[model samples]
Target: MVSFGDSKFVKKVCGITQASYQHGWDERNGGNVSLRLTAEDLVGFDDVSEVKRTLDLGFDAKVLSGSYFLVTATGRYFRNVISQPGLDLGLVKITDDGQHADLLWGYEDGAKPTSEFPSHLMSHIKRLKVDPEQRVVMHCHPTNVIALSFTHELDERSITRLLWKMQAESLVVFPEGVGIIPYMTPGTNEIGKATSDKMSEFRTVIWPHHGIFGTGDDLDEAFGLIETVEKAAAIYSQICAQGGEIRQEITDEQLGDLAHAFGVVASPKFLS
Candidate 1:
């Protein structure tokens, strides 16, 4: 008897979108989120039996054939998700051929998945290969992160180091470092592929001058990754606004020590 609006996944993602919007991260329809679903997660949903509609994915998602996802809808605003989950979200099952998806629930007004759905799927496929337990792929436009994107070098190593130095826990939380892709048009296969390539080694990817993509075993982990990075970026921005006077900062050796203390190996590729 669980309705679409009553589902926990629906509630969680919607709440996240609302939080993102309230935090001023997702403006308008600028950000989207997708969470892979398991059979158990859909157990109580009585309306998922048949396809409500079908939409082309525009890219091969065969690796995810038969998989189910609860995702935001196209042109939907995050602020309204919690208030109207049925209209702002949808559950889709990847078609057998992977070129399409069958909408099973929600999207009340016939809206489709986010235009960035391809990117979400692409990153999901790559991240799953990297960590089979991975289940969430989130993208958002955090103001501070976008600001850092312009103020900081677009190089992955440099940004990684900068974020790690900005906070003691940065290296521990993202030991593999963050990946950065060249700015390209969003919602395209090309951007999707580039982000997928980065996902091969990093759980977090930065879309320079745009936003960020984060993957994790669950919703909180995915959101946490992005949250941590955003916080670091905020600190960096404030430092600049305050005259860029740095009496001190975390040193490389200290970062190594912190990583060892946390038992997560910092990326040697990024660390000096």
Candidate 2:
């Protein structure tokens, strides 16, 4: 049997957490990540069904019952994940009843999953409905994206158009555009439901003045989605700092051509 320590999933979690910290996206424990896992992924791990403990999820996850997830622990700094994966990450299986999660491995120091687990789970549930391959949910405070929340209009259509024009790759990376949710207290069912609802139509959702929730089929895809938006936000920030005047930017027609070339459908509502 392969030890959990040597599992690829564990390594992936650790690597992403380290990268997030290095990029200044997850200061302290300000962000969280959760990756849905299939039974095939746990084939080599012994005692996969043994529950070390149970945690109340505060929301029913019946739809995800019997599924497994690897998530960063609550209050655990991303900076420490690479060096101490066992203490900063955990493997949990949603109980059949859906009211609790059974700890299967990791979180060796008795840490719990991130406070945003509900949001992550909700997102996972919603995304999977749209794309069966969906497997990852990542939340982080990208400096520029959060800054844009303060200076840019909160309307999803406006924010989507602005980010699409800020960089050439914006439309391709997030062709469906981004979702925006007004400021709300984090780690609650209300926020989770709001974010999840957005996930039904968008792969990325920005929590105004907070952070972003990105979903994808894997860690890199999810992280890249957030990274692309954040980079576009940063470019917009630089443009504003230079004068807040647009001399030239990607036009709607040009955006259409680019989207056509990429074979991706840019959000129609934002286009002329």
lDDT of 1 by residue, 1-272 (tens): 65766878888997789888988989988889999998787876678987899988898899899999999999989999999998989999999999999999999898999999999999999888878899999999989999988877798889899899999978988999999999998888899999999999999999988999999998889888999999999999899999999899999899989988989998889889
Model 2 off-target regions past 4 Å? Answer: none
lDDT of each structure?
A: 0.90, 0.92
Tens digit per residue, CA lDDT, model 2, 1-272: 66786888889988998899999999977899999999899887785668898999998999999999999999989999999988888899999999999999988889999999999999999999999999999999999999999987899999899999998999999999999988999989999999999999999999999999999999999999999999999998998899989999899999999999999988788877
RMSD of each: 1.0, 0.9
lDDT at 255, model 1 = 95
Per-residue error (Å), model 2, residue 267: 1.3
RMSD of 1: 1.0
